[model samples]
Target: MEVRAQLASVFHLDKCLGCHTCSVVCKNLWTDRKGSEHMWWNNVETRPGTGYPPLWEDQQRHHGGWVLAGGELRLRLGSRPHVLDQLFQPPTLPTLDDQYEPWTYRYGDLLGADPTKDLPTARPVSAITGRPIDPSAGPNWDDDLGGSAVHAAADPNLAALDPDERQALLAFDRLVFFHLPRTCNHCLNPACAAACPSGAIYKRGEDGIVVLAKERCRGWRMCVPACPYKKTFHSWLEGKSEKCIGCYPRLESGDAPACFHACTGRIRYQGVLLYDADAAARAARAPDERLVDAFRDALLDPADPDVAAEAARAGLGEAVLAAARRSPVDRFVRDWELALPLHPEFRTLPMVFYVPPLSPVRAVRSDGARPVSDDLLADPAALRIPIRYLASLFAAGNERVVVDALQALAAVRAHRRARTAGDVTAADAARLLLEAGLDEATADAIHRLTVFPTLRERVVHPPLAREGEADRDPGIQGLVGLRRRVTS
Candidate 1:
């Protein structure tokens, strides 16, 4: 039972005003040099739209991280050194375009001098490519235009529409907004370290912060694709993959990482957590309940005399232990009563935990009367809110699909609870689901289903049953009819 110190970050999204002060400070400190100008060791982007690199959510297209197939977790970067060597080999003239094609739009063109300007007169141009831009193809061209999870949660009337109609309404209303700020998760089970051909990427023994040893690096860029968050960057000047060091120099002096210290929103917190390395490794291998249970047990209680004695004996510092006592991860694990890996299905067992935002639904005017939409009742897509994209970035599973499924399950549970009470308010149900760990966007989708009039009728009962039905008939036909009844 060897105890290892881990560096963990706690972000309070409620406090995050989407200010880029943290990003700017970090860029000035680490990424301002040549060959790193385009690199943002830290960045903030609007979510649901493509991230900076565009479609970063499509992991299948990127071929990064582990995949579960045939009941086994398969590492894409081969386990052998030679295999990693081949995988990491540098490319010729490695440019930002290789990783991300920078793009921007012309907003001024749409606001032309003339009020009645049309077609050619209203067209804008691209800033980077310098081509005549199509307003339809530019960055954030549709920013915040689609119906958001927050909107759906606030207004439950949307749930009754069909998926296609709901999508159209979202596109038309432009209701949702999400802020995604990214940095290295510095994972407990880091794929970048595991995929390293030269073992250059190693987790610090003292802090569990995954770091790339510059000199030890073989210049194989496998870490670029191996990272689910895509935080690792290939440095042409250094000819290696580099990432946030968790500001080790700062941490050594009992200071926070640069980004955390500089954050205007106070969204970041640094602390130590005790974990079972052996159990984490085992989780990386089999990836089942035993592994999940292992994580649940590895939680360290700084106040517990026995746990404190064990930590001190394992060489953990008093300062580290002190911080762990008041850390956010400890609070979330022990008090908040919520546990979700950033992306559990990915099997990387990322330690980062996000407490999902519970967005409020608001009343909307419909047809000159206050008619609530049933968006929360049937369609999961009506939740126009955004879940933290970090889950898909660091977690070891099918990040998007798994999160979506979890949201659906939560919605079902909330709906059932509401039905039991005989007072089913789609908005209330959606709020309940949001509180249960579903992101605003997904919760709103469920809310929309619950509120939609047509969808409510469709989903409240099976297609085979009408008004009159016998309660206690035990015949096969009667059982089928009972199953077909719409109780809600």
Candidate 2:
């Protein structure tokens, strides 16, 4: 089966409060140094708006991810010759304007201004140029749907909807948005690693975390657009590509990632997933409609005896398999089938999955007294956030998967409300749960994991065998290899 253990995550979008605590903490920890001012290794993007590095999801323009041509999977960036042709000047690289210019306030101006003058203010200046400039954009400039007319209107996911539906989404009173926090997906088949001409980027075999070795980097900047998610960034000062490392140092010590740990909404869950490595390509090659299911099929159940034997033979430790058995990500993704990957059509096989959010019920006033739903829990189609829109974000234009996830979420809420508020009977809640294809016990378990999981239950780090490794530092290893090459 070619079983391999991979670290994975699940983010419950419904719980995300649009709080930037995750972003701020990730920034303070990883990308705060010079030349990385514009890089947010972790960023929370407001949906229905152009995300950071505007229009990154528009693969037609950026030419990121993979494509199947003549039944053979290949880089969407084109053949090696084409890549070489554009090596010096990649045609699809995002410009500085695309990624907002990082800036800082001129605090000195505020401090040194004449006392007699009117209230002194700090003028905004470019972090790069040290000159005063008008601040026009930021990573989360369109947060809470700010500048919806301009930025939100340009969202690429809107292209999937009909013209009328698109218009309705942009209408002032009808506007609805949600938070999408992002980082490097640490994809199973990372295009960034495949596209790196210098072989600098690599995915760790033990844990599937993609990382760039700075010592071997040649400042090619190829990984930038090669990543469909646009998580890889070029550092102008260091002349090397950088990205989120998944906070391996923290993970090695049995802790969750910085962003996951700092999240105010408790929306993040980290754990290990055991998947059949041989099946990844076939899964990625599946048709758009079946892509999500195909990917799910690639994840092997750790509890399976045959799978465990294969995993052990493949060098996975017992500790890792045990963690994988308790993995909340596995439950959310494979067991309950509630979480789905973002843009499965990208064919990167991202390990991180998201539980599609359930939006507030659309208000239809009756006699102008109050807004209410026709159905008890409100239909998925009647939610403020359209199932089609979420499908575009998560399911590769397949609305059915998104609808199923929302229905399951609704059932959980209904069950909880029935228990706590007594508005609905236990029988009624049971019917809703059955309708959603879940048993009462399963619903209750989902409720506990979603709303009130302990920290241990939230993040389950696998045994990486890092303790016994001799050459732990890549930098030192790189230097040793260089000295040997020169001496030889």
Candidate 3:
């Protein structure tokens, strides 16, 4: 049966409060277990700063995401199903020494002692690696992707100047900030689904939600790297790859995802969207403007009768169709034209939409003005929009996308400054943090941890043959050992 298509999304700039309430709610409901402490199915982060686990965006350094090969966007996971399945399996447990090592802070050791005239600052070192642990790195490092404070920290133009001078320069120049909360985009053409060897991952017919059948999963980790967003994760305990299921259980019952339900911003909206199934498949196989642009254009009118009819013919329920008719996303997507896809170039055809942030440019001036009324820096959320973060989502290999996106947001802020014709003082709090040299250090840390090794090694090597002797290969050793152990 043809599956119906539905969509949902969060407005990072408007609704999230970074309170961790959503994360806590989800943790207690789903991931609060022995192996889940490090896992946050729903995590909130401080933008313009490193996110949890740090620098997850430096996909180039980490060796993740898509690559353009022979003019096609090739998912890092091989095109074949078998190859992807083989990679999806869970990993074997490392020895305790490898998994859990003791940790301590060196500076903590000097707290109460009679110290030298100049007391040294605290530094952290890893007990296991015996190397100094840089404090500022992780998966979500650059959470705001260096849009605000991090940007100011990285740019020498802003770094060398004093606070007042920097504020004057910013006011003179005009700047802005925004926030982008992200999750699995659940693309119309999902690389994760295509890469599945067992055909276990499939998009639902009812709502276009993607799902993975645990029993059919062989624990290959191909999907982990295949997805540019890094949304798919391998469950070592379950020995399978898993990802966002679009909260199907709740969706079926007319509710929203755990993250959406718990979102304080109320920026999330859920509804059905109709796209030509044939077109979707074509886009999945061969993405281009003709196909992808058509789908995006349809999002502009998700509630059109023709669209609803098409969705119904695709096996969507009347209730779902009715919901789509009134969905706020439909209005935002079509009428207001405020929503845009997170990353269009990934060729995954993601469905989430974001309302561009508009706060930063209103804060500062380029002409050494006094203060302006339109500065976004006055608002924290406005400070969260970093081009780096968006570029991380869209431009997998290039850093320019992030720079461009940031500049675009900054332009918007600049426009606000021009409109308001006001002078403003830049917040020293964000500026001081930027000057302390923390952002880049943190981004570097996140990039290191998110690395997924793709080195190729033979699991079963051929036996070497001595001169004139028939040789047996070592391929059967594992089987033989298993048999012997079982029989004995």
Candidate 4:
């Protein structure tokens, strides 16, 4: 019954076009400073390929996120000695090969070179050191090459697939990939916050935005790998750990985040979610197969009368509750069950959810014929991407949730086709909805919300109930007006 407002987000992966527009705007706005040359707070990673920082999902190497031991939930960092060793030892952290060394062409060499037989060209020089260096890797080096034998072969998701399925995914024409834009999940039970000895990282009480107080940071470097998503970074130049602020300043002004605003695909949705604080632990401890449903049960329906009364007792703002009632995040995640949390086995209870993309289920093509929108995918097993591969990312190795999401997506397409054209039978569309566990009305709403949502429908920022302090304080930056400074 303890209600708290969390500003959660959802990314409809089906709509993402691998454009990287969101990443570019986020970099220009926040991570452009001296200490942040290598930090990409918002990054778009291609699936079936090792993501940024290479093999980040391989927690065996990074030791990020949480694990259940002896029926108790604890951080994967293990004992105190392990934490100290991992934190202090530079070699244990991400090497230059892991996160590519940031480099820029030495334009001075290109422009002001002495006359030569060949046209003068800029040599690649390390951005950190002005010295010339050979460059090989980059953040998105594997973009669109998810089917490459070299890059995709190294994906941790492929480990979930069998040898035969893996070979098919790597084959020339069977290749398919999708974009996965990532940011700090701002998790309910953040391991980064728990792992920080300095207590510099904390989730804000009002909005649930996880923040690292730079003033209290001691350059411990523990929070970097402690973040399962690898969202936290150590600023070598500044001697502090930093991460995405979740664009709180823009949110306070009643505007969506820069990345959300700049997104061309309109794939991002942000809103408040009210959850029982006590249920988070229970949900985290649930069995792997039931973990997703358990987490979904944690969110209290904002429309419930008892929830409103309990929210008032728990100090949830009236405005915050109203936002939750109409939150698109709630509709996608809780109501319709379209969006599911990423890597829930990590047990961080990440608030950000993703609507599994439909690109993996390529329509069946016959001899000398073209694939059409009305035609449904023949079989999940014969899909372009393996279900086990997606299961590893979204369902923690359970294919049922992934299958359900795909079926729902297919039903929507068939439903729309039947309505607009005679290519698909209406009875088949209705039957598809039944198999997908969605009603016609629900499917239509999902269609509008995804394809034709207005700006207001897409973003639902709650009133933080800061009690008017933020507007009054002229010196405020990044919700500094509302929260207290915890100085060590």
lDDT of candidates 1 onward, in order: 0.52, 0.83, 0.47, 0.81
**Tens digit of per-residue lDDT, candidate 4, span 288-407:** 888888898899899999998987766555677788889999999988888988899899999999998876444444343445544444244545777788888998888988888888
lDDT of 2 by residue, 245-285 (tens): 99988876667889988889999998888788678778989
TM-score of each prediction: 0.62, 0.93, 0.59, 0.92
Residue pairs of candidate 4 with colliding backbone atoms: none
User: Who is ahead in TM-score, 2 or 4?
Assistant: 2
Top candidate when judged by lDDT against the true structure: 2
**Backbone clashes counted, model 3:** 66
TM-score of candidate 3 against the unseen true structure: 0.59
lDDT of 2: 0.83
Model 3, which residues run further than 4 Å from truth? 1-4, 49-53, 61-73, 81-179, 278-295, 298-305, 362-364, 367-488
Candidate 4, 201: how far from true, in Å?
Answer: 0.8
Off by over 4 Å in 1: 69-73, 81-95, 101-169, 285-294, 338-340, 362-488
Worst 10 residues of 1 by lDDT: 458-467
**What ranges in model 4 sit over 4 Å off?**
80-87, 360-379, 465-488
lDDT by residue for model 3 (345-374), tens: 556777776654433433433354545433
Candidate no. 1 TM-score? 0.62
> What is residue 488's positional error in candidate 1, in angstroms?
57
- Looking at model 2, residue 5 earns an lDDT score of 71
Residue 307 Cα positional deviation in candidate 1, in Å, after optimal superposition? 2.5
